[model samples]
Each structure stands twice: as structure tokens, then as C-alpha cells.
Target: MACSGCYSVNFMAVSSNPNKPLTSSTLLTSKLSSSYSQIPFSSLNFNSKLSRIQLHKSNTAPNSFVVVSGIKAEPLKVMISGAPASGKGTQCELITKKYDLVHIAAGDLLRAEVAAGTENGRRAKECMEKGQLVPDEIVVTMVKERLSQPDSQEKGWLLDGYPRSSSQATALKGFGFEPHIFILLDVPEEILVERVVGRRLDPVTGKIYHLKYSPPETEEIAARLTQRFDDTEEKVKLRLLTHNKNVEAVLSMYEDVTVRVDGSLSKEDVYTKIDTVLRNVLGQRQAAIVLLVFPCDMFGISTA
Candidate 1:
């Protein structure tokens, strides 16, 4: 059955005999409601007083979930950290596409709030216009609401631009959330500035391009590239300063669980290194295995 836009399959078989009542060889095909509260049963066969019951599924199920003899499932949690212009967004896009992990970007949330004319967005815009920081509670509240959504359950998630302060980190812990891995993208300040200043956004599609690193094909289209007001060198420098100070403080508060990657490298190279780090952290055979288990294919889902 499909729940939260994803399909899942579950089945159970029961026998009345106490000994040799159920075995793996017992064949069963039954249709069951997806809800956990409802239990579905098929005809049962037993040799002795029902001692045990077993469940089995055919290969035709779209998403097969079998309960082992004795094992528990754990939720996957991950956090992504980087300074401005460090290509965190680009890398996150790749990771989310490769693995179904939900990508929650703080900056995108703030931008969307401001665009939507919400009270929080209005306050944030005022703070931005005055060159002041938005209050932490507002940001944290937004993030908490986003995480509480039903879609975040079971699947893995990649959180970006959150826990900007050690206080926020402590708050997250109090809320019963801890990241399994924390990734830091280490890019040189000069290179980051260059990348930021050269960047342009297509107003229609919101596609970002860089004049030096990823230019458009035609000169006419390239000429149409528009630079963001905040992408100026001065703004980038200020953002970098604030980010370094905040991130350093936050990192110091947490235990040693960070893996730093040089963001100045090519996109593919960075992805390779990140994939390796995630595999090691998650103890998965490959990054694709993690992705297949965490699929985040929804749009307009608040990553706040």
C-alpha cells in the first residue's frame, strides 16, 4: 500500500499448532491493508500445537519489508555543514538524487518565507535589510515544524544550514535528534568569493550558473545572466565571516563526528569523497543503497 507517496508491503501468517506449526516453506499469498493498526490473515496449516508463526512474501511486491527473527530498525539521520558559496547546495542535489535523503536547506527556507510575505519572512526580511541576524527561535521553530511532518519518518534526511549555533545544537538534542554524520565543506575564502561573484541566476527557472566555472552556451544567453544582489564581494565576505564564527562555535560544542571535504575540487570529485564518507559513516555497502532506502522525491516539502 502507498503511504506518504511511497509503497510498502507487509504480511503475516498464523498457525494453531504449538510445535512444527509454521515453517519458512509455508507458502502464502494474501492482500492486506497498509495500515499498521489492521492485521490481515490468510488460511493457516499446522502440524502440531501452533508454536510459531512466520510471514513470507512473493517477489512481485514493489517494496518488500520482512521482519527478521530478531532485529530492530533504526532511523537514519545526517547533517550537512558548509560556509556560503562552498557548493553545499550542489553537492546536496547530487546526494538527494542518488539517495532518497530529504534535503533541508535553511537559506532556501528563509528565502521562501520572505517571498511568501509570511510574518516570519517579513521579520527576516526586515532583519536582512537592517544587516541584522534573524532571531534563532524563529528559525528553529520553522525547522522543528518541517521535521515533524509525516514524510520525514522512516526515510533518511540531509539537513543544511541548521544548528547555526551551539544553542541550537543543544536544542536539537533536547528534541531527540542527533546526526549520525556531520559534513563540513572546506573551501578557500578567495575561491569562494570568486565563485560567488561570478554566479548568475536565471530568473525564469532559478538555475544558477557561474561565468568562470559554468558559463552558458551562447553569448546572448550568457549576457542575460543576472547576478544576485547579495552575491557581491563585500556581501560574500561578510557572510563568510559570520558563517566561520558561528560554525566554529557550533562544531566545538558537538563531539568529533565531522568529515571535512575540500569544496574547491570539481563537483564530481567532491561527490566521490562525500559518497565515501557517507558509506563509512552509514556502514552501507554503497551510497546507492542508502539512497534507495531514503528516497525524497517530493517537491515543495518544507525543509525548514
Candidate 2:
């Protein structure tokens, strides 16, 4: 076992008589004593800025001071885009937990501003009430404010369904909120349409269910299911068409750092692929072991 503080450094013993080769401990103690005062401890890699120097004598051939520098990686800034029913919500939940990031849904933020009745919220409400899309500047302002918050600054953020248009993309850059990576969850158009059409929402519980993929556990809950007006086949088809036309343009804008994931697969499989990419971007070693110790021996767990 190697001590965290110090390890043996072995160099080949040089001597004509193999039987009486120079011993490392004897040579080091005698030769290094005077030189030690001139040798700056700060220059060696001991994993710490202030390392406690210790010399270990081992029977092994080669041993030297080992330094393990702790790496604190930069926070993640991610953007996710997908059509409705592409499972961005589910995947975002997994990503937030795994990476310790904040999830910011652009649509949710707009609604929240409206709910708060702020000046910008009132303007957004006027447009929404008239069935007109809110101006790009208004949405961008809200996003800019949200991203500047202390929580977002500290934990980083995963932006969802933002910069839907080219102008909005420019606004994002102006605000200095460029995403490190853009993840596009791509599903077949037919599959997206099928998922949307079969989806049902529980008005009371706000729980969503899919008649085909996932139905209510009991008939009683089934009775409470309601299909959203937007989930109608005609409306869903229109939405899909619009997404198809614009999604490529948005994706191309971030092609340099974009990663496309197949959302048509099982949710777990999709997430596995996503997790692998995230680990690479975050500079995590896949083979490294993480040991977590709890108080009083209550728990001792290791993860890789």
C-alpha cells in the first residue's frame, strides 16, 4: 500500500559487485542530507500545495515521492433541445442529479415571470393572451436575469428549449451564456406523433400517462385522465412539422459542440449514452473509484 504522503523512489543501484550493490536508504540518507536544505519541497508533486515530507525505506527496487494533484473541473453549461414527448424532462432530471446542475426551462421561466406579475410578466401576458408569441427580447431578458442569479452562478445550469430561433441564439451570445455543449434528443417524427397523441394528463394529480406506453395502474385513475387540447393529432402534426423545419437550423448553429442522442430508444439506454458524453466533457475518469465514508461506520460505499 502506498501512503498518500510519500512513496518510495527506486533507481538502479550502480556497482561492479552485484553482491554489494549500493542500497537506496544508505545512499539517500548520506548523500541527500546536505542537499535537502537546498531542495525546495514546493517543487515536488505531492498532491498538495503544502506537503508533509516523509521518506520511506522499502525492500522494493524503485520508489519516489508521489504527488496526486486534485483536479477541480469547471462547471457544466449545457443546452438541450427536443420535440414534445421526446423525454427531455425525464433525461434532464437524471442529468441534474448526476452532475449537480440547475435545470432552467425557458418556457417555465416565462410562465413564472407572468405568474409573479412583474413588469416583464405583464408584457408577456399581453402577448400570450392574444395568442401571439412573446417577443424574443422579452424571453431573452428573463433568461439573462435567471442565469445571473447566485444559484446558477455556483452550480451551473442546463437550459431546456431555449434559443428556438436564430435571433434568440444571438441574444444568448450577447448575454454571455454560451452552452458548452448542445444535446439534441432526436426521435422519429412518427414516434413523436404517436407519443403525443396517446398521452393523457390527470387534471387532479398533474400526472401524465401514455395510453400505449404507460397507462393508469387502475381504471379509477384512467377515468380521471384527460387529453390536452394541444395533444390532438392535427395539432401535434403541425407542431412536428414546425419542429422539423427549424430544429436543423438551431442544431447547425451549435454543430461544433453538438451531440445528437437517439431518444427513440428506451429511456435508460438513451440516458446511458448521454451520461457517457457528459463524463467525458466533465473530465471524469471512468476507471477511477470514488469512496464515500459515512459517520460511525453507518455506511462505507465505493463507486466507479
Candidate 3:
């Protein structure tokens, strides 16, 4: 799983206050507190405790970030699972911005291949035309290809809407591509079905909007918006049922690392919860590697 794009930060000690930037002297002299006991670091282990998260924001809006001590032996890898209309896309965008991760939507990749008329696309298209689920191997192949790209290998990835079944999850692990963290968004069935009713997709950008909550801003955008054939309440119900069944199997494989959040919450709230989880995961110690997080002043020291 090693790649040219991987980045590793090595630190001998950590500063508990992210706002107070760590100095070379601090690195050589800081002591580990009883609460933040020194935990052995490893490349892929998430068992180590997160050192600290300090946030700073302006009065009008929160534009600050949390910094902590952590290490990543490999690029960040994340997976998302949720019922239809559970705000997965929105959260993915936030996570990408916060973590600088590649947003690898499996459905989007398949759609692109089909649109390009590639062999895999043709095969998948034929299967879909017959109302059959596209085979897992085809989907997995496309995913592997996408992940192998330089951007994904370097920046890491946020995998959306793949590995629906236990076998598919196993295939991912078989390739040594198991996610560092598996996120599950929990929403009420009623809310999910209701959201589906107003859903709209822009074929050009692949961005979705809700007619009531977030309509297209311009007339041109609205005119080009299209609804999926399966957006109906009945369809939503069926999809939800099927997804729950698959997720049960999938979750079993990721129980130790899975973090579930309430998708019914407001967008900001949901993102905040997810952000906290990822920060904690990233802060985990490994191989005596201390990831020093500095409170981003937006114009301050660039971690990038």
C-alpha cells in the first residue's frame, strides 16, 4: 500500500495547546501528561488516544481549525455509508475541504466510465439496462483504478457509495485498501423518504439539490435539473431497506473503527460531529510519530 504520495510527520513530543505553536525546544522538552498518557504509535492503528484539539474562530463565523498530535503512515482513507438522502455528499465535501482528501464517489466513477463508453462501462450499462445490479468486480476494478491515480495516492481518499455487501468489503481489504475509518450516517426512515421527494440532480456537475431546502440558484441551473426515476417514496423505501441489509453486513466488518452519527441533525451539526471523529482518528499516535496540529489562522503556518 506504500506510494510515492505518502507523507509522514515525526515528532518527539506534543504541545497540548494547538494555539501555542510548538517550538524546537518544546519538542525536546515537553512532557506527556497523565491524561494524555504516552501510547505506543504504529502506522495503521487507531487505538492510540488523540492528544488534543484546540479550535479558534471569529465572532461572526467559525473559520478556525483543530490541531493535535497524530501520525499517518499511509494517506488518509475514509469510507461513508448512509441511506439515500442522508446528506452523504454534503458531508463528503466538508471532509474533503477539512482533510484535503480526494472525494471518490463510486457511482460518479461508474457513470463517467459509462459516459465514456469504456468496455467496463459497456458491460455495466448492459447489466443496468436489464435492471440488474452492476457486478461487484467491475465496480471494484474501476475503484482500484481511480485510487491508483497520483492524486488519490498522495492526498488520500473519501470513498462514497461502494462496498455495499460483506463480500465487497472483503475484496477491498483483500487489496489492502481497508479504510482507516468507516462512517455511518443514521437518519429516520420518514425523513429519508421525505428528502427523496424534492431531490434534483444536475447532470453536468453531478451536484444534488432539494427543491425546498436548497433549490437551484439560477433559472438555467433549475431548467437543467432532473430527478432520478427512482426518487419516488416507494423507491426510496425499497432502497433504504436494501441499504440497511447491506450495511448490517458491512458494519460487521468495520465494527472496531466504525463511527455512526445522526444524519437527521442540521448540516453544520452533522459535519461538526464527523469532523471531531476524523480529527480524533488522525490524532492517534503511531511509531512514536507525533503529528503536531497548529490552530490554523487561515493565514498562519501552512501544513500543506
Candidate 4:
């Protein structure tokens, strides 16, 4: 590992040839010691930061794990857009986990503000109660407040369902939140309608289900399912139409960094394409493997 103060370990896997990778043959060539006072796994901490440590506990090798370290990546800013039923939630969950990012769905943030009853929330409530759309300034303020938080500053953020118009898109850039990439999940309007119509939500568990694609696991859950008032086919169609009409404005601003993904594919396939694009944006990471050892072995010098 490149980290300083890491020399306390008793048995560092000092590679004979740093350029050549260690193979099973190399392990077999040496007479392995059966009793070295094996280290526990929980005590090792490699100071090097690489995608939130991405720790993987190995079952095959009880006392060992491969440590991956590299130049820490920049705070990633990913902006994604899709129709209401385009599986944004599922993809956001995956992307945020894989990249170690904060998920900032603008709608969620606005709702949270409203729930907290802050000054912004109060104004938003007035507009909402009066059946008027919340002003762009209110939405932008909520988004900016969220982006300025410590978590967002350190972990970066996945901006979802934001920048609905050219003014909003420009406003984000003005606030120094220019996105690294703009991803559009393109699903047909007909499929969007189909997905919305079949969708049901379990209000108690807050779990969503689709009648055709992914149904309730049990009859009890099915009986408890409720569909959102906005999930009706008419509203879904209008949402899709608005998304299509205004997406060009956002795309035009970020044309150089824009990537459109096929939302019709299986979730796994869709994520594969997204992962590839995000990796490209992240670029090459200078990495090395350090043998993970517990505190008893890794922290103290062996007198023997």
C-alpha cells in the first residue's frame, strides 16, 4: 500500500517482482507457515481511499483479502433524467452504491423540505395547497441547499429528476454544480404508460409493485397494495409528453457530455451500459494490492 505509517505489519506480502502479479504457483513454491498467529480481519485499515474502500471480505482465504488502493477520484457529479415510470429509482440505487455517491432526487428533497416545515417549505406548501406549481426559485433553493451539505461535498451526488428546463439547467451551472455527465433514459411513451398503469404501491411498507412485471410476493401484500393518484394512464402520458418536450433544452446545454441510454432493456443490461460510461468519465485509477491483515498481525512487529 502507498499509505504512510503502514509498516507496522509483521508479514507484508513483499512481492519479489512488483511488476509481476502473484500467482497460486508462487504460493505453492514456498512452504507456507501454518502458525503465524493469524491476524483478525476487522482491525486492518489502509489509509488509502479508493471508491470508499470497496472492501471485500474473502470466504476462500480466511485470513487474507486483496486490498485495492489507488489515486482517490474526484467528487463525481452525475445528472440523470427519465420519465416517471422509467426505473430511475432502481438505477439511482445501483449507481449511487456502485460509485459511492449521494443520491439527490430533487422531488425527494422538495418533499422533505415541505415535511420539515422550513421557510422554503412553508412557501412551497402555500403554492402546493393552492394547486399551483412550486416556483423554479423555490426548487432551485432546495437543490442548492442539498448540494452544499457536507455529505454532498465529500461524496459527490447523483442528481435525479432535476433541471427540468433550460433556466434550471443554467441555474445549476451558475451555482457551480456543472454535471460531469448527463444521462437520459429513453423509454417509449407506450411502455411508460403500461408501466404506470400496472404499478401498485404498498403504503405500509412503501414498496412498489408492478402487476405484470413484478407482482406482489404474497396475496396479503397484494391486498394491501395501492396505486398513486398520479399513476393513472392520463397523468403518466402527460408526464411523458412534458419530459419529451423539454429534454431537448437540457440536452442542448450538455450536448458534449450527454449520453442516452436504452431504458427498454433489462435493468442489468441497462446498468452495464451506464457503468461503462461512468467508468470512462472516472478514467484510469492507479491501483495496487495490499494484503489485508488484522491488528494482531498487521499492527505489531513479530519478535521471532
Cα lDDT, all candidates: 0.65, 0.66, 0.71, 0.69
lDDT of 2 by residue, 189-228 (tens): 8899899889998877877799999889999999989986
- Write the residue-wise lDDT of candidate 4 on 133-218 in tens digits: 46789999889988899999888899998888788988989999988889999998788889989999887887789999999999
Instruction: Please tell me which predicted candidate would have the highest TM-score against the true structure.
Output: 3
Better of 1 and 4 by lDDT: 4
Q: Which digits, one per residue and each the tens of the lDDT, describe model 3 over residues 1-304?
A: 1212212234322333322333333332212221121212221123233443333221222233333454336777999989878989889999998899999988678777788999998887775444345688899888888888999988899999777788888888888788889999999998998898899999889889899989998999999999875687776776777788788999999999899999999999999999998888777723446554333433242323
Q: Which candidate has the top score in lDDT?
A: 3
To one decimal, what is the Cα RMSD in angstroms of model 1 from the true structure?
Answer: 13.9
Off by over 4 Å in 3: 1-23, 29-72, 117-119, 122-133, 286-304
lDDT of 2 at 229: 56
Off by over 4 Å in 1: 1-69, 129-132, 217-224, 284-304
Task: Candidate 4: give the clashing pairs.
Answer: none
A best-first ranking of the candidates according to their TM-score comes to 3, 1, 4, 2
Q: Order of candidates by lDDT, top first? A: 3, 4, 2, 1
Model 3, residue 163: C-alpha shift (Å): 1.4
Query: Candidate 1 residues 97-118, lDDT tens each?
Result: 8777888887778878998999
lDDT for predicted candidate 2 compared with the true structure: 0.66
Off by over 4 Å in 4: 1-73, 113-133, 284-304
